[model samples]
Target: MTNVSRWAAMLALLFATAAWGGLFHAGKLVLNNVDPFWFTVVRYTGASLLLCGILMLQGKVRWELLREHWRRLASLGLMGYGMFGILVFIGLSYSVPSHGAVIMATMPITTLLMRWVFERQRPQLWAWCVVALAIFGVSLVSGVWRSSTGAGHSTAFGDLIAFVGTVGWIMYTRGQASVSKLSVIEYTTFTAILALPGLFAFAVVATLLGYANRPDPADLIAAIPPILYIVVVGTVLAALAFNKGVRTLGAVHGIVFINLVPVSALLISAAKGSVPNGSEMIGTLLIIVALSIQARKMGLGAKAAK
Candidate 1:
């Protein structure tokens, strides 16, 4: 990539990471007043509708192509949107938002491992070390290594769930690699449509089971602003920007940039009075460094392969 092009790609990646980082704080803000499942239902439902409208406006709607990849699309939807979304919310409920963000810092490492294992394309030794460092860093960030018993057992459980969510996202990204032949809008729309019913079902179950508490009117009103931000900027705009960045930088390089998400979330959380202590900062730094190293290694490997 030329210097200018590379700089543009980096900027795009940074913006995309910031958008995703805001999701942790945004979701936390809404979760204070709304049920997690219901929040996802609303978020994904709105995103799906918005994408559908865009497709219609562009005259690019293709019902037949959706039918052709129905199974893969549904799997992606269920795992990526439905299961991953709901589980992360649950994990957040049990853990700190900053901790969840830090855990997510491991996504690039997880994606690399999955690609290596499933695709049989081994990464460099440094890449493996980076993954190990990220995993350790996540444990520290989650307070799993602070206990006299060697990280409180409950923290371990929460970390495990958060890590699972990270794995789910990595799988989703890998799946996207195979389906990149489709336009981003088309792929996003299909995933959203397939996930819609499940999201609604999850919301319904939460409400019926009394898991959803009614929010105060003020709280509901407060949530509206963040909801709008999430729907418009976080989901729609970020998706578009990420697709453009990937086109310019390629997937491995584009994805490595997501390491910035934890940093953004940490800063946002600190501003919101959820500051992490020195240990947490150290852990976050370790994870970011690990992910960066792993990403660079992967990017180089891709270039060598090409």
Candidate 2:
């Protein structure tokens, strides 16, 4: 890409990550009035339709490729979209948005570990150290140390669930190697469409089982604004911008922008008069520093390899 294009891509990625940072907060608002499964169903209903519309307009549906890879796409969609959404939203009901953001910021390191376990691609010793630092930072951000004191225990628990959700996302990302023939937008649209049935099923089951209550029309109305933000900015726009930026700037360079996720979340929270505590601030800084170091190392290694 040209320098101008690269700069634009980087700017796009910055905004994308910031939008995603705001997602946790927006999701929390919706979850206050809607159950996790229903929220996922609602969000993806709009997102999937819009994405399919985009593909249809572009004449890039690639039905043959989708049919050939139906099973893998469905499985990944279930994990990444269905499972991640339910768990994270449930967790958000108990935790704050900044906490969720910090936990998710660990994704790159977790992806590295997943690579090690699944692909046997061992990371260097320094990489392992970075992982440790990231974990420690997450603990501080989640206030895990305060759990035993009957303070922030639920937040810590929620953070754990959120971390597990992040793993689902990592799996979905890694699983993309199998569907490499499809473009990112194509894969995203297909997986989202495929995931909708499973999301709907879960929502139905939860409502039937009394685990989730059907929201009243008033409740849904109250949630409409945040839900709209989540679908339009968080799901569709961020996903498109992120993929485009990563494609243009290269993964190593693009990954560094993840630092903005937690930062933006905290800033948003602060703006709403929920400033982060000292430990949370410190933990956020540590994770950002570690990820920055890791990204720099990876960028240097990539250049050297070239």
Cα lDDT tens digits, model 2, 97-118, are 9988888788888877876887
Displacement of residue 57 (Cα, Å) in model 2 is 2.3
Off by over 4 Å in 1: 1-9, 148-155, 205-222
Candidate 2, which segments miss by more than 4 Å at Cα?
Answer: 1-5, 147-154, 248-256
Q: Across residues 1-306, which tens digit of lDDT does each residue of candidate 1 receive?
A: 688987886887788789888887787777877767777887888888898998799885788888888888888887877777877877887777777777777777777777788889887777778878987788777776676463333355766786787666666655776676678778878888988887787778777888765455676677998888877777777766776677677765677887888899889988988677877898899998888777666667787998
State each model's CA lDDT, in order: 0.77, 0.84
Instruction: Give the C-alpha miss distance for residue 304 in model 2, angstroms.
Output: 1.0
Candidate 2 residue 299 C-alpha distance from true site, Å: 0.7
Q: Estimate each model's TM-score.
A: 0.86, 0.92
Candidate 2's displacement at residue 130, Å, is: 0.8
